[model samples]
Target: YAMTAAHKTLPLGTYVRVHNLENNRSLVVRINDRGPFVRGRIIDLSYTGAKDIGIVGPGTARVEVVALGRRDTSAAGSATTYIQDDYYSGNFTFQVGAFLDRENAERQKRELAKKYKNAHITVYDRGDKIFYRVRVGRFTTLEEAVQQEEILIQDGFPDAILVAE
Candidate 1:
């Protein structure tokens, strides 16, 4: 699937939400190319796209995709202009763990905080399920986030992945 964005460039694996008209179901798909370009279409789905909307045999279906904004990649050290009321919010920060057990997550957060001063945990509730996330650092660029992920992996958190804010 492809996502429509104001900017011409889009990175691969960019997630887009696709909604099926028939079933009112939605699925997230990755964008890898230019676009659908049809008159009124928002996204172009592949032959296996039917499976996403829960109809494998049907060739085509009306669908809508809400394109989540792309990642900001402005270079570091660029002059940033802030309005009077605007504070420097800094960059995006995320943790490594999103566990179901809060105690386990807290334990991990404490252990990580000893090494990484910025380490913290957040709890999320989705339906009846609970999730605990452990994250560190406010990174201004994706490169910094990736570097931190590498350091975390080398420190034994091999399963760590970079997430956007």
Candidate 2:
């Protein structure tokens, strides 16, 4: 219920300042979930967040977003702490697709595996439903995954994107 938002590309847990260009109101929000997948949208704010910035009634507003580093999720309750975004070394992968059906995900994985090493599926349980995410290759750095993303795109997986696994 704290101010939180969703972004397609920002790393989860990153804090960002959302500035409403229409009303000149701004607020800080944490990136937690994964979308606003519409063609031209950027961020999806919580209901309270939208109301605070005076955009709830019209349902959409032009806003500028500024990343303000990442939140330290490890720390105890309510004591917010932020860490620099520069230092992160973790498992990264290239996600080719996500499917609601397990069989569809498996089919995609099999096809990917024929030409790519480490093609697999990871299940994301979203409480009421599930998603099987098809992914290929695993790397310890973002650069490695990004390089592979381009290859995957060229090879016909146009929606391939780098994801922190």
**Cα lDDT tens digits for candidate 2, 80-150:** 77776752467877778999999999999999899998999989998999999998998887777778878
The TM-score between candidate 2 and the true structure equals 0.73
lDDT of each: 0.60, 0.85
Give the poorly placed runs of model 2, Cα more than 4 Å off: 9-11, 21-23, 57-62, 70-81, 87-89
Best by lDDT: 2
Model 2 error, position 48 (Å): 1.8
Candidate 1 segments exceeding 4 Å error: 1-90
